[model samples]
Target chain A: MDPTEREVACFEAGIKFGTLYHQFAGTPVSPESAASLERAMEAAVENQPHCTAVDVAILVDELDTTHDYTELTGRYMEVHMRIDYGETVVRTEMRMEDGYPMMRVVDVHEE
Target chain B: MDPTEREVACFEAGIKFGTLYHQFAGTPVSPESAASLERAMEAAVENQPHCTAVDVAILVDELDTTHDYTELTGRYMEVHMRIDYGETVVRTEMRMEDGYPMMRVVDVHEE
Candidate 1:
């Protein structure tokens, strides 16, 4: 699909990067788009000079039968962003952990 | 893609029904599979008699450039299940609010 359609899919899928933990419950992404996602991650790193060497992993798990709920799942992304506050050239790794649905900013700390 | 390919895609995407939020960041899902997902939701409901009408909405949002992170995104799925503890017929709507890459169960309770 084209970018516009893809955007619509995203919109329909209701995936907001900020609130991704609440979206997709559990299912694998298609290959066609997966390639673009990897590229997007790379771009996310390249675009942000303050951020560098970002690593990400998507995780999914099945829910126990006891809860009558579908499988429980989420995603995880880690990044190394450069922090420069005017004069401070601080290099730190920012990890976007425990993402749900697509991805989310779980915790950002110096690593 | 066939079921196997689709499953593989999900696997590569690292999507587990238990933890889907950490995978996809900000981008729409392709259409071919979206239909299957909707079907899956329905099946999830049919399979679980304890669960009734499972209303789900996929939400994706763009993140501001304050921290230089990608757009904020996620998905949301709501479900209503019947509670029959041998005799108790409880009808409740379980909102699987905010699905991420594909989907993830964030919160479940009286809703």
Candidate 2:
């Protein structure tokens, strides 16, 4: 079955964020693109009106690989991403090196 | 005093990582840019010969703001980044919405 509208909206928001983030990393973008990005972001927030209540985090290791490039050699980060959720917060981290994603419940009192 | 070469290297690596990360995030780049990014990655690894020994994680909430763009409105994530360290792992999370970054030692003994 297809994803629900809200689910699709959330996924789109993530993609839009990722797109704009990279697009504007060290350069300027056209005002038109910026506007589109802004609209997407707003839609995302609206889709997750209660995102403030979820909290999450993820960690991973031994997930990157080092390859030798004939002209240029280096390691590519293949980290993992994690998420933590709770009564009033939502946290998400992606560890690209590892292939799996994790979700957890947070304990705020200990800290 | 100015940052040491090694420290500078670390900072540069972070920057380069961010740069390449955003640059090649969704779109492909020229072979030249790709090669340069690869070289920088290798240099970063050489600089962090012992990153495998550190562990860290960061969590934050109450970040992001919505602004009116006239033409389009959306929220921007101004999160904080937290780092967790340990004997064999290093975990870092950027909470863009929050203003502060955090660091902690992992308690792997728990599930």
Candidate 3:
């Protein structure tokens, strides 16, 4: 069976989450570069269809600065995304949970 | 409402695809770096839950070759991913479609 609009809305949110995480995960970062990278990541995913907004916060203090820069990963960031698919809307976010980076849906609705 | 197992499986597959595409999209690549990037990308996504395998092919011939490197993007690569979620398995691939790098599911089935 084809997916319902709600399912698709969930799928779209998932895609944004995946895209946001994967695309920026390995970028080099330091306290100096974190802000720009966050803005760039937000702008990148917002370019996708159905995405209304993307918020990224890179934890510079937690970043490993041994080499003056480190690879970005879930541990160093958190994200929020809002996606609207037709009348169905989804809000999702990713943050550290139980020592793991977890992406979870906050709400799903139709308007 | 809750997403079904199948829906969750589909969502997982989407995450892997997103991770694969985004995490490596902006990487600096040349023929010399393509092979190593491919291997590293595969290993990275495979660390995610439910992801079984990842295959990445950086189109060395298609690379810009200017400055001996270029930022990676969907146009410069092709990818295939397999994910297993309990009894549900999903197969997907990404390629250039109609001038856009499109990621699509090839099959979703239950065992």
Candidate 4:
């Protein structure tokens, strides 16, 4: 069966977010890290027809005060992302698992 | 922030699917069981604005020839559902967790 527009948007967003997470796998949340993620996301979805615009936000876990990048391992991230595909928007909460991003669909809707 | 259209659709679909699963908590898959789930789903989203129509399909695990509904406790189900909300469609895979449905958003998209 054909996937719905919402499904396509969510799937594409998942791929972009996965790439973004990989870019910061072993690094802590810093300004430069955020910029690199944004650039990676832009590049990943640039040629996609449905995804017109994309925005991603990475918020470090407040409990991670030590900036102990090495200690914050496993699938335990507090990062959230928002992707805009003009007609549809997708929001996701993701966690890192073995250096890969595993996302949960927080929301998806039309503009 | 206001949730996007896709998010709202996925959230509502989650609720409906959750209710549908609860209605068949300890029952094995049978024609009667399927009918009961369908009826429950229809009632759950009957008045929702965006969800003009909804359809669900439950495929029992092929290995579940024993029909051991009780043995299939825990979060180990092979049930999948498809929910259509005119402009959007949501597909979910669910497992029973302590007799309640725990769904994973397999896909969601616009029509």
Candidate 5:
């Protein structure tokens, strides 16, 4: 099936976030990195058949880079995702772990 | 100095294209893929100080995937890029070569 508008928008947002993250982190967002992020989003809602949108944003003000710069220091990010199948909304915080973006759910509201 | 609006837009476009390319190619746009594209863009106008924007578009109608799908078959793409420095505009055709996006100048006009 052709992807929905929301799906396309969500995917586009993912791309934007990937670029923004690399820009602030002083790293370049490579295609590999983007694929990793796409996999993460898929994993996030793997079981949800109706999941349509996934949005990720950086809390720029909350970003902290005080750790050793020589090593990869995972930073916090804000995520708001939507699952249309169940009218579900997921709000969470996430960070990179071992070079992978991981999320911790803060809220899941079902409408 | 802060990045120019055009720079940010170009970078964002790069991200979008990376995703779009993978979506169509059935492969994945990785961090490495994005980085390589960025490098190619840099190389395109490295000497130009006022270069600002780069845009990429897929020639969906021209896309011919009749070849072996298992292998990376580089496809042609349409590109319109701008360099504000010399008031330049770059219109070209590009494709993936050896797993990297490569461009060939079709037209370069300064206004």
Candidate 6:
């Protein structure tokens, strides 16, 4: 069976989430660099097709400040993305779930 | 609509590839850090469910020598990943396509 355009849209949404999570996870980040990193992440993913917007928040309060900076990880940030494909639109979010970062589809509907 | 096992496998493969690519893409890299980075990437993705093996190679020779270190990106590395979901197995690869990193499933089959 062939995948519907809806399924393709879902797959694309998953791709964006995976990309956002992986691409910046281990970067050296500190409270000072968090804002810049967040902006960079959003701009980087928005370059992808059908990605209408991206929002990234680095939890500065939770960052391990044992040193001047720490490696960025899911435990320290949250993300949201909006992807539109054909007439279908998908909204996804990522945050701590069971102490691990989980990305999931929040909503999907036809425009 | 529902996705088949193969599709789920493909989606899983995509996540690993995306994670592998994005998680490490912007790290400051010199020839010295490439090996450790590769190992960390493999270990990280391997922790994900259904991922069996991951191979990452950073092209040291391509480092932009104008500076002691450069940001990692698709132009600097190649990745291969193997994922198993139920009886379905998927192999994925990432390399430059049209001058951009492209993650694609190389094979999917049921054992």
Q: For candidate 6, report its TM-score.
A: 0.68
lDDT of candidates 1 onward, in order:
0.35, 0.26, 0.84, 0.51, 0.41, 0.81
lDDT of 4 by residue, B14-103 (tens): 444434444344554553355565455555544443444455444434225454433222243445555565576767665655665445
Please, what are the lDDT tens digits per residue for candidate 3 over residues B1-111?
Answer: 455566567677878888777767788899998999999999999999999999999999999987999999999999999879889877778899888997766777788
Error of 1 at A110 (Å): 34
Q: What is the DockQ of candidate 4?
A: 0.04
State each candidate's clash count. Answer: 82, 46, 4, 17, 13, 4
Question: Residue A92 error for model 3, in Å?
Answer: 1.9
Ranking by TM-score: 3, 6, 5, 4, 1, 2
- Per-residue C-alpha lDDT of model 5 across residues B1-111, encoded as one tens digit per residue: 986654453444345344334433422223223333333333323222333545544333444435311211245444455444334454444566776676555555557
User: Per-candidate TM vs. native?
Assistant: 0.26, 0.24, 0.76, 0.33, 0.34, 0.68
**Tens digits of per-residue lDDT for model 2 on A84-111?**
1222222222232343221111111111
Candidate 4 per-residue C-alpha lDDT over A1-111 given as tens digits, one digit per residue, 9 for 90 to 100: 444566555645554443444433455444335556546645654444344555544443432555433322224344555666557777766565566544567767788
User: Between 1 and 2, whose DockQ is larger?
Assistant: 1
What DockQ do you compute for every candidate structure? 0.04, 0.04, 0.37, 0.04, 0.06, 0.26
The candidates score, on chain A by TM-score, as follows: 0.31, 0.26, 0.96, 0.52, 0.33, 0.97
What digit string (tens of lDDT, one per residue) describes model 6 on residues B1-111? 345566566556666776777666779999998899989989998999888999998889998868899999899888888888898877777788898877666666789
Best candidate (score: TM-score): 3
Candidate 6, A8-70: lDDT as tens digits = 566567678788877777899999999999999999999987889999999999999998899
Decoy 5 TM-score against native: 0.34
Q: After superposition, how far is residue A44 of candidate 4 from its true place, in Å?
A: 7.8
